[model samples]
Target: MVLCTCFFVPPLQAQESPEVDIGGALRFNYNLSSWKPEQKTRGGDFGYDLFRINANAAYKGIYLNAEYRWYSDGFGGGMLKQGWFGYHFSKNKELQVGLTQVPFGIQQYNSNNWFFNLTYYVGLEDDHDMGIKYIYTGEKTEYQLAFFKNAEELRFGNDSEISHSRYSYDVAGRNKEINQFNGKFIYKFGGNVLQRIGFSAQYGSLYNLDTEESGNHYGLALHYEASYKDWNLKAEAMNIAHNPENAASTPDDTILMAAYGAAYEVAADFNIYTLTLSRNVPVNWGPVSALQFYNDFGYMQKQEDDFEDSYMNVTGVLLTAGNIYTYIDYAAGYNHSWLGGNYIDDFSRGTPNANWEARFNINIGYYF
Candidate 1:
């Protein structure tokens, strides 16, 4: 046996890999007319809509993500959209704890329209809260569960100026609503034409600080999406049941009825349905590398027996090239606030009380 003389080799130090990425977005908006019926002639507004910064850091299996934004008009100050830290067991699973988005409805929404759908106005979509959440993304399924405290509307003070636009609706006042739980699941199937179906639910308990009473709110949603060729279609329907004590005395209840002609009293419920269709145009010329046409429709039915139904329709075209994007939309509404019409339960303003209006909106964004 040949003896092999070997020198001792020092073990290499295990290096810790770290990564960080920073990004930001700048947006601008120009309006041809205002949405409020009382301010029909107001238009020619041009200014910065939003400026935001996003950052992410990762080391080992731990990560941190944050987003801070500045809005020009309504908010009038910087705000934190999301800030979260989590441990990632794998690429498909994570447990996060911090201020993050409430995973109750379609993630990021399906419409390219700037205002989104009616669900957003009711605090069911694109809303964030302080929460602890777990997410699991499998090959054909995705699941999310979270428990939140101090939702977006309740977390902020009531000093901000209120506008009739979509960005100014705050349903949760200074109420002590806590222990809100949100859950969602989505399953994907189909081959060439990809398809997905999802279900989401949220529940919370509210304690009226003013009246010393307690109540609850529950919501459920079903959504579906499909992609065929260059066209994408999405449909969502949701029901929200509100059972707040002394609902007639709540500011949100009063605003809800006054703004949208919907009452959220004891056992008050409402249903919303939204449908969107988008297609990519086969044009990749000049500075515009991509073009898409989209249309969105939303309908809301209130629980009151004599209440008239509300609807909104938006049509727009979007263009994208590199990190620059822009969209132009024409929106119309019946019995909707942001869309133009102002519906009141009493109809005291008469039959022709500016029940409908149309506006042109353009938004441009740059990402870096």
Candidate 2:
């Protein structure tokens, strides 16, 4: 999520801006889930509900990041997490020196809803670590490398709804990286396609700061992507399950998969995208996860002539569960510079817990 407002004026191209400005996303959340809370006496509580507020800052190139949210302290015995910070380096090289997330884990895929679809189509893995990153930029080339100290991986299906980073995969996976390193490269061709390759490796214990044998670990990742006009495709393969600890008492434990996605402009004001994923639960293909995949389909529609602002979108999961639930969103509002900052847009209802849940969020989205 991000924020950028400039009223009483028209859209300013990059060449129009002189100084490096700052911006961010200020989000407020209100939801009601069907899960009941536990009471001390009855060893049970009632349904869980919460009101939350989150703010994220974005500085042109200096920094762009968000928070973990702690607006509501009481949410079914859950833990709170603060956001992270990243420092921009010379050119594009950067050193994220805060509680940033792990950059590995997911491949840079092509999807119209990648930016807004939180659960239905996108996967954001958060790891608590004081890390650093180096990004290389060229005319048609790009690369990135990241590392972490106290690394942790969130559970797949268990990290949603309220997205609480509570139990770590280190339970069955005490696997932490005392030090983790990753690298990726992207090159453009004459046609309208991009080629990408990513590699990640790490070593350490359950506690990144510890030296326990039971928590030692290491792994690697590989990915590829191509894009043309309003269409794109991506695939990722990995072997995180591989170990000298296979079920056959052999060094043969691994999980691998390949994913594909495509998008097309259905109309001038609407774009449609669909993704298909397959995860290899049977065997490991070399250093790749055989079939760890899911299918995500979405539609993005918007209209902006010279009047108001509006958006309607829907993302659905056609693959496995624990991967993504579903989402529906509609937003519309207008901005004017002559007056103080003020805006409101809410074209949705029946959200949160309804069978056909609809998420309609009204945002004042004020900024100076």
Q: Which candidate is the best by TM-score?
A: 1
Tens-place lDDT per residue, model 2, 1-368, is: 00111122232222333333343333233222122123223443223222233445544434445433322334323332334555444444455655555555334323222223221211222334456655556767766666665433333332221123331112222122345555556664555544454454444433211222333344444545555443345544333321222133321121111011111111112122333332224334343322222233322222223223222232322111232212222321112110112211111111122122232322222221
Tens digits of per-residue lDDT for model 1, 1-368: 00111112222332289889999999998877555444445546678888999999977657899888877544445666778997755567667888777887677875668867766666666776777888878999998888887554422444432222222223433244467888899999999999999999989876665556767778899999999999999999999776666545443332232112232212146788999999998676888888899999887777655455666788999998889999899887766655544433321121233456566889999999
Residue-pair clashes per prediction, in order, are 0, 32
Angstrom error at residue 184, model 2: 3.2
Estimate the TM-score for candidate 2.
0.43
- TM-score against native, each model: 0.82, 0.43
Local distance difference test, per candidate? 0.68, 0.33
The deviation in Å at residue 277 for candidate 1 is: 0.6
Best candidate (score: lDDT): 1
Q: Could you tell me the lDDT of residue 344 within candidate 2?
A: 14
Show model 2 residue runs off by greater than 4 Å: 1-64, 70-82, 105-128, 152-177, 194-197, 207-214, 242-294, 297-326, 329-368
Q: Report residue 293 deviation for candidate 1 (angstroms).
A: 0.8
lDDT of 2 at 202: 43
